[model samples]
Target: MSIQDFFIFNCLEEKDLPLLHRWFQEPHVKKWWPVPKEKEDFFDSYLKRIHSTEISLYFVSYGNIPIGFLQAYPVDRSKETWLPKLPKNTIGIDQFIGEIDFVGKGYGTSFIKKFIDQLLAENNEMTVILDPDPRNKAAIRCYEKVGFVRVGIFPRKGDLALLMRYN
Candidate 1:
């Protein structure tokens, strides 16, 4: 079964952090974001804020078995590190398929596509933005396939990426 088969957004709970930590240690995650060395630190310090931010929302799902993590935040409200002048209330999504076995099953793409559609519906004036590493060509292609356009590049602390906008 795919994420499309049973995709719903739910808030991240205390019990969910164990699974999230497992996902973080997976090979797929390390390949994409390889800085954090400890899972305890990530959750205690970072994941605690999943519920507070109105502009940023996170979901925990059992995508055919609940083995992934997904998060979306307003472009203006979340990480102001690498985006251009976003539309007034625009939201940006940053997600990952941590289960290596689930990597190429179209789950990640389907989840984001559906989620973005819902976000846009709510904030019609918003523009969704993303910045995928230019080195990761496959990801760039996937974003383009879903109607995101390469807007420009912005440099972050460690990596520089191709900024994309979905309007």
Candidate 2:
């Protein structure tokens, strides 16, 4: 099936926390997202911030089956020192395909492109940014396919990342 046919995006709800917690424990996801060792602590923290005005989080579905998570926030709202250097209206994005079966299937590129398109439509002046691990060659390539150009490499939370932008 085509990517568009399978993908659906919905606002994340409090009821979804358990599933998200499970996804966080997955080896593939844990490698990038430093989810807290204690599930309750992680859930509490996420619940507190999920409703922030500066952030938006969504659940990614494929033909009604939830398969991933995506989130976006104003770059300036980030605690990372380097993010404020981006344009004023820039939005930073973070996402992961939670379902193991969905990896390497080209779904990420399709869903990310659609999500960015939606974000831009909602706020015409906004610029989108992403910082993926430099070692994740597949993710970097997917971002490139969706028009994100690597601006530089930078440190985030003590780890190196490839800073990419789409305007």
Candidate 3:
């Protein structure tokens, strides 16, 4: 199905935290998006920054049902060393399909493409970036399918990551 067939991006809300926490606990998701050992701790820390001006958090929905999480922030606001090489208006993204049933279904590529299209439409001068673990071949392939090019690998938070850009 096209993105229009089953996708809507909506602002994350407090009510969504429980499902989000469950997603975080999933082995596949936790490997990439590590959270606190306690769910409450994770909720406390994440909720505190959900509405930050420096970033935007979204829930990816399929026919109005939330299925995933996505976030975007200015590259300059990031602590990653490689982000400084990009233009100041560059934005970085992080995303995951929270619903296990949706994994490997090609929704990620469509969602990312549509989301980036919207971002570009809203800000003509902005560039978008994504950093996924190089070991995650599936994710790398997905990003490549959405027009993201591999720029290079960089160390981020004690791990090496593959940096991809869509401009």
Candidate 4:
């Protein structure tokens, strides 16, 4: 069941840092999302103290209750280094259901559907992508339900990931 039947992507702000920090510490999140421990380091994990223009961060909420975090970024063709060549208009996503109580209750798929729908509505031709740890079956399943197609495995963040692109 969904919580309050609402899925919103609230613009992230400094005020949400504490909540964000707490989410990073959740065991479920820690299992897949290896993030910094300390608040300062954790903030850094968000990149340039959340000032990066490359990504858009959001607080996913069910009704008025914050349930998770989601971030989207465009692959910068100019800033080359690693990363397999992707579509020039590709948009990558990273997200987690922060509220432990909300895990595995179908909300992840619901939120993702709404979020991706919005992104496509904005730019239907824009390619959306996500790379989940090869072992994160739950996440992979959720993503698949939302229309992501398997694109093979690749090294990502010190581990192999099943890079999937929206199709």
**Best-matching candidate per lDDT:** 2
TM-scores of all models?
0.84, 0.92, 0.93, 0.90
Q: What is the lDDT of residue 77 in candidate 3?
A: 51
1 versus 3: better lDDT goes to: 3
| 164: Cα error in model 3, Å | 0.5
Give the alpha carbon lDDT tens digit for every residue of 35-149 in model 1: 4577767777556566467445455355446756666765553457455566676666777776677677776777778778787678677778887888888777778877899
Candidate 3 per-residue lDDT over residues 9-30, each given as its tens digit = 9888888888889899888798
Task: Provide the lowest-lDDT 10-residue window in model 2.
Answer: 77-86
Q: Each candidate: RMSD to true structure?
A: 2.7, 1.8, 1.6, 2.3
- Clash-forming residue pairs, model 4: none
| By TM-score: ranked, best first | 3, 2, 4, 1
Across 52-120, the per-residue lDDT of candidate 4 in tens digits comes to: 787899999998889999999887756633467887899989999999999999899989988998999
Q: What alpha-carbon RMSD in Å does predicted model 1 have with respect to the real structure?
A: 2.7
Error of 2 at 71 (Å): 0.3
Query: For residues 53-163, what per-residue lDDT tens digits would candidate 2 score against the true structure?
Result: 778889999889999999998777556786537678888899999999998888888899989988898988998999999998878888999899989998767778899
TM-score of 2: 0.92
Q: Which residue pairs does candidate 1 place in steric collision?
A: 62-66, 63-66
Candidate 2 clashing pairs? none
**Top-TM-score structure, candidate number:** 3
Better by lDDT, candidate 4 or 1: 4
TM-score of 4: 0.90
